[model samples]
Target chain A: MKILVCISNVPDTTTKIVIGADDKNINTAGIQWIINPWDELALTRALELKDAGKISEVVVANVGTAITEATLRKSLATGADRAIRVNTEPADAWTVASNLSEVVKNEPFDIILCGIESSDHNGSSVGGLLAGMLDLNFISSVSGLDIENEKLTVQREIDGEKEILETQGPVLLVIQKGIAIVPRIPSMRGIMQARTKPLQIVEATSSESMTETVQVTLPPEKGKCKMIDAENAGEVIRLLREEAKVL
Target chain B: MNILIYTETREGSFKKQGFELISYAKALSGMTGGEVISLAIGEIFDEELKKAADYGASRIIALEADQLPDNRNLSKLLIQWIKQANAQVILFADNNTGKAIAPFVAAGLKAGIATGITGLPEKTDPFIVTRKIYSGKALAKIQVKSHYKILLLAANTFGIKNDPVVPVIERHNIEAEYFESPNKIISTEKQTGKILLGEAEIVVSAGRGMKSPDNWGSIEELAQILGAATACSRPVSDEGWRPHGEHVGQTGKVINPNIYFAFGISGAIQHVAGISGSKVIVAVNKDHEAPIFNVADYGIVGDVNQVLPKMIEAARKIKTE
Candidate 1:
C-alpha cells in the first residue's frame, strides 16, 4: 500500500503572532517557521505504518510558495520517502484543494492523511474537501485508525461522542488531536538520505479557486484577570450574571 | 436577497450548533436587510425546523434524501438551494460537517468565506470580520471583499439568545442528486465521560505531571465533584493516558467555558489556543513561571500529586458545607 501525507509550513506556536501593517495578513518577518504540529502526527503515523510493513512508501506533499520547501525538507527528515510541492501560494482551502487534486490526478495512493486543520487557519477543511474533489471516502477529526487487509476502521471525535467508522482503502482522513502517536524526529542517516530523494515542484493552474489576504489584526489584549475573592464563589457567579452576563 | 443557514442534523434531531448557525444567520439577516432561510437536510425534522423560528429563521429549506448523508452531494444541494434562494450571506457552525462543506459550498457558489469567526462582521463595506488567530493569542480582522459572503462561526463564540419575535418557519423543497460513490457510516463509539466539553461550564485538565494514566482517577474525581468535564494536555493524549477527544491544544478542540483549571500543565501556545476562551483560568503547576500562569486568574505553584488530592478534598468539603 502507498500513503500520501499533506504537510503545511506554519509559524511556530511560540512566535508572537503579528498581523502585517495592513492588519489582515500574518507578519512573517522575524518569525521562525516549522512543520505544523498536527501534520507531524500524519507523517509519524505514516512512518509507523511503514515500520509495521503495512505500506511501502510515504510521500509528503505541500501546497505553498517556494519558502515552504524548507518545511517539506524537514518532513523528509522526519521519515517521508519523497516530497512533492504543488508550487502555489496556498491562498485558501479551495485553492489548496484544487492544487492537491491536480497533484493527486497523477499519483494515486491507498490512504491520504492530513492534520485535522492547519495551525494558521485552523479550518479543518482540507481532508474532506480533498476527498470531495477526489470523490473518495473521507472522515474528519479522527482520533484513532487501524487498517487491515483492504479495509480501514477509524475512531472519530465528534462534538460530545466518539464514533468508530469502517471503510475501504483509498480513503482520506483529517487526523485530529489526542489520536495516534506523536511524530518521530528523523535520524541523522535519515536526514542525510533525504537530500538525495526526489523533490518535485509544479505550478498550479488557474480556476474558480482563489483566496486573497485582505488584512490581519490582533485581537484586543485580554483585560486584567479578575480574581474572585475566596468564600465568594457566589459573588463570582453574580458578577458573571450581572456584569459580564456570560452566564 | 436572502441569507441561507445550514442547520446540520445527526440521526434526526437538529444539533445545538444548528441553532447557533441560525442565530448568527438571524443577526446577519438583520444587518444585511435580508430574510433568513434555514436549510435542514437528512431524515428531516419539522419540529426542529419550527425551533428555528425562535431564533428568527423565516424560511426553512429542506432536502430529504439519501444523498444528504454524503457531504459531497450535500454541498451540491446546498449550492443549488443558495442559487435558488439568491442568498447573499451563508452561515454555518464550524463543526466537522460544516467545516467540510462550507468551503466547498462557497467554492461551488463562487464566493469567498471566512472560518473561525468569533462574531458578526464588524463592518460589511469591505466585509471585515474578526477571527481568533494564533490559538487565541491574537485576533485577525479579515476582509472578504466579495459581493457574496460566507461565515463559519467558532463554537462558544456567541451564547444562545431567544428572540421575542419567533420566526415563521416555512418549508421549501430541495432537490438532492446522488453521487457515484457514497461514504457509509458503519458504527459510532461514544467517548465515555461525565460531560461533553461544549456543554461543560467548567473543565479540569491534566498534563504529563499526572505521571501516568493510572493517576487520572483523581482528576476525574475533581471533575465529578465540580460537575465538569475532564481534559488533558497533548502529551497525555499522545501517551494514551486519555482519549484524544479530551486533548485541548492547538491540534485539539477549541473550547470556551466559564472556568478552566489546569493541573500540572505548563502552558504551551498549542494548548493555550484550545482553552483560551475560559473566563477564569487557574493554573496549578510546580513551575512558578510556566506559561499557563501567564493568563491564569490564580496561580498555585506546587506538585500536582500533593495539590490534587487536597484540592479534591477541599472541593468536596465545600460541597458538603
Candidate 2:
C-alpha cells in the first residue's frame, strides 16, 4: 500500500505575521518558508512506516506555485521517495483540497495523511474536504496509528477521552502531534539524492475558491504588561481580584 | 432565511457550548432575518432538548447518534437536514468534533467555510465574516461567494445571550441502511478533571520553568483557590509530568478562558497561539525577555519557587475576602 502525505509550504512558525501593503494577504517579503510543522511530522511518520516495510511508497504532495518546490525539496531530502507539486497558489482550503483530490485520484494511494491544520492559515479543513471530494473514509485527530498483520488500529482523542478504533481499506487520517516524536532532519545522502530525485509538477485541477479573503489586518494591540515587583508579588492576587476580577 | 446549528451535548445534557451556539445563531438570525433552528445529534436527554429553545432556538430536532456511525454519515445527515429546513447558514462548535466534521458538510453543500470565527459579519451585503488567521496572530475578513455558508465557531467567542423562545422539538429517525461502515471501536478512557480545561473560566499553566513535576503542587493549589483548571505546556505533558489531556497549546487543546496564568512558560508562538484568545493573561517567568510577556497583560520576574508560594498564599486569601 502506498502512502501520500499532503504538505503545505508555510512561513516558519517563528515569523511574526504581518499584513502586506497589499492589504488582502500576509506579507511574503523576506519570509522564510518551511514545511508546515504538522505536515512535516506527517511526512516523517509516513517514511517511518515505509522504513518498517508496512507501506511500499511514501509520496509528498502539495498545492502551490513553483516557489513551493523549495519546501517540497526539503521533504524529499527528509526521505520522501518522490514529490508532487500541483501548480497554483493555494488560496483557500477548498481550492487546495479540490486540486489535491485530483492528484490523489490520478496516483492511487491506500493511506493518505494530512496535518490537522496549516500553521499560516490554520483553516483545519483540507483533509476533511478532500475526503468528501473523494468519498473516502476520514479519521480526525488521530494521535497514534499502528498497522500489524495488515490490520490498522488508531487511537483518537474525543472530548476528554481517548478512543481506540480499528479500521481498514483506504483511509485518510488528519493527524495531530504525537504521531511522530519529531520531524526528521535530512541526512547527507538524502540531501544529495533530493537534488536529483523526481519532483513532478502537475496542473491544478481547479483554481476557484468558495471563499475570498477581502482584507487582512493585525489583531488589536494589547496593553503593555504591568511589571509587578518580586517583593510585591502577592499584590497580583489583589489586582486580579479587584482590577481583572478573574479571581 | 433559516440558520442551522449543530448543538453538542455531554453525557445526555447540554453544556456551555450548546447554549453559546444557540445564542450566536439567534444573533445571526437578527441580521439575516432568519429563524434559528438547532439540531441535536446523539442521545440528549429530553429535558436538555427543551432548554436549547431558552437560548433562542426557534426549533429543535433530535437524531440518534448511533444511526450515523461516522462523520461521513453525520455530514450526509446534515446535508439532508440542510435541504429539508432550507438552511443557508450552518454553525458548528469549533471543538474536536467540529474540527473533524464541518469541512465534510461544507463540501456536500459546496459552501464557503470559515473556522475560528471571532465576531459577526462586518457586513452582510457581500457576506463577509471575520476570523483569526495565523492562529490568532492576525485577522482575515472572508467573503463567501457561495450562498451556503458553513461556519465553525470557537465556544465562548460569542457570549451566550438568554433570549427565551418557544421551540418545536421533534425526533427524526434515520433509515437503517444509510451507511454500512467497517470501523469498530475497541475501548475508551476518559480522564475527568476538576474543571474541564476547555470550559474553565480561568486557567493556570506552567512549563519547564517549574524545574520538576514535584513543583506542580503549587500550581494546582492556586488553581483550586481560583476555581481554575490546571494546564501545562506540551513539553511538560510529553515528559509524562502531566497527562496529555492537561496539555494546552497549538498541538493540544485551544481554550479562551476569562483569564490565563502562565508560570515559568517562555511563551513560544505555538503556546501563545492557544492562550491568546483569553480575555487577560498574567505571566510569571524568571526570564525577563521571555516571549510570553509580549502578550501578557501583567508580568512578574521571579523564580517559581519564591513567586509560586506567594501566589498560593495570596490566592488562599480570596475566599476570606
Candidate 3:
C-alpha cells in the first residue's frame, strides 16, 4: 500500500500571534514553526501503518514556499519514505486542495491522510475538497483507523456520539487527534538518512484563491478577572447569577 | 438573490443551530434583499419545518429519504439544490455534519468558503466575512472572491430569533445518488439525558489538577447541579480520566457555551483556543498565576476539591430556594 500524508507548517501552539503591521498577515519574526499538531498525528499513524507492513511507503506532501522544506525534511526523518513540496504559499483551503489533487492525480496511492484542519487557519476544508475533486471516499474528524485486506475501519466522533465506519481503499481520511497519542521524534541517524532521501519540488497548478484575508486583528482583551476569596465559593455562584447574568 | 440555509435535524427535531442559521440568514437577507430558504434532508415533521419559519425562514424545502445520505452524496444533493435555487450564498452550522459536507459542496460549486465564522459579513458588496483563525487567538476578515459564497457559522455566535412568520413549505421527492459506504456505524455510545458539551449553555470542565479519575465524581456532581455539560483539558482526556468526546482544546471540540467554568486547568494556549468563544469564563485553580486567569472573567485561587463542593452546594441551594 502507498499512503500520502499531507502536512502543513503552523505556528507553535504556545506562540503569541501578533498581527503584522500590514493588518492582513501574521508577524513572522521570532515565530517558531512546527508541523501542525494534528497533521503530525496523521503522519505518525501513516508511519505506523508502514511499520506494520500494511503499507509499503509513506510520502509526505506540503503546499508551501521553500521555507516549508525544512519541516518536510523533519517528517522524512520521522519515517516518511519521500517528500513532495508543491512550491506555493497556500493562500486558502481551496488552493491547497486544488494543488494536492493535481499531485495525487500523478501519483499512485491507495490512501490519503491529512489532519482534520490546519491549526493556524483552522480551515477543515482541504481533505473534503480534495476528495470531492478526486471523486473518492472521504471521512472527516477520524479518531481511530484500522486497515486490513484493503478495507478500512474508521472511528469518528459526531455530536458526542462515536460512529464506527467501514470503507474500502482509495479513501481520504481527515484525522483528528488520538489516532496516535505520541508523535515520533527523529533520531540522529534518521536525521542523517533524511538528507539522502528524495525531496521533490513541484510547481502548484492553481494560483487562484477563493478567499482573501482582508485583515487580521487580535481579539479584544478580556476584562479584569474578579478575584473572589477562595473561602467564599458560594459567592462565585451569586456573582455568576446576579452580575454575569449567565447562570 | 437567494440565500440557502441547510437545516440539520436529529431524531426528527431541528437542531438548535438550525434555528440560529435561519436567524442569521434572515438578517443577511435584510442586507442583500434575498429570500431566506432553508433546506432539510431526510424525514422531517411539518412542525419541525415550521420552527425554521418561526425562526425567520421565508421558504422551506423538505427532501424526504429513509436514510440520510453520507457527506459525499449529501454534497451532490446540495449542489443540485444550489443550482436550482439560484442561491448566491449558502450557510451551514459548523458542526460535524456541516464540516464534513460544506467543503465538498464548495468544491463542487467552486465557491469561496469560510468556516468557523463568528459574526455577520463585514461587507456584502464583495462579500467579506469574519472568522476565527489561529484557533480563536485572532480574527480574520476574509473576502470571498467567487460568485457563490459558502459559510459555516460557529455555534452560538448568532442568536436565534423567532418572528413566527408563516413560510411557504415546498416538499420535493428527489432520488439522490447514494454511495456504498465501506464503513458502517456498528454502535453508538452516549451518556443518556446529559447535555452535549457542544450544545450546552453552561459547561464545567476539569484538568489534570483534579489528580485522578476517581475525583471526577464531585466535578460531575457540580456540573449536574448547574445543569451544565462536563469537559476536560487535553491531558485529562489523554490520561484516560475522561472520554475523548469530552475533551475541549485545539485538537478537541471547540465550544461556545454561554458560561464556561474551568477547574484546575492551567489554561494552555490550545485549551484556551477551544473555550475563547464563551461569553463568560470562570476559573478555579490552586495556582494564582495559571494562564487561565488571563482570559477568565472570574477567578478563584483555591483547591478545586474544596471550591467545587461549595459551589455545587450553593447552586443546589439556589435551585431549591
* Chain A TM-score compared with the true chain A, each model in order: 0.91, 0.96, 0.97
DockQ of 3: 0.73
Better candidate by lDDT, 1 or 2: 2
- Model 3 C-alpha lDDT per residue in residues B170-245, reported as the tens digit of each score: 9988674464455576666654576878778899999988988999999889888888999999999888888887
Per-model B-chain TM-score: 0.87, 0.93, 0.95
DockQ by candidate, in order: 0.38, 0.73, 0.73
Q: Which regions of candidate 3 fall more than 4 Å away from where they truly are?
A: B179-192
Ranking by DockQ: 3, 2, 1
Looking at model 1, residue B293 earns an lDDT score of 75
Which prediction has the highest TM-score against the true structure? Answer: 3
Clashes of each: 11, 0, 6
Residue-level lDDT tens digits of model 2 in A1-247: 7889999999887788878888999889889999988898888888888899998888999999998999999999999989999999877899999999999889778889999998888889999999988988888888888888767888887656888989885889998877887789999999999999999999987988999999999888788999999878899888887998766
Clashing pairs in 3: A165-B183, A166-B182, A166-B183, A166-B184, A167-B182, A167-B183
lDDT of 1 at A20: 73
TM-score for all models, in order of appearance: 0.86, 0.96, 0.97
Q: Write the per-residue lDDT of candidate 1 for residues A1-247, one digit (tens) a residue.
A: 8889999888887787866766667678998888888788878877887888878899999888899988988888878889999887666777888788888888898889988787887766677667767867676767677778756777777765777777777888888664546568888998898898888988886434434555566655555555543333334334434566543
What is the per-residue lDDT of model 3 for residues A1-247, given as tens digits with 9 covering 90 to 100? 8899999998888888898999999999998889998899999999888888888999999999998888999999999999999999888998899999999999968889989888899888988889888988788878888889877888887656777888877888988877998899898988999999999999999988899999999999988999999999889899988999988
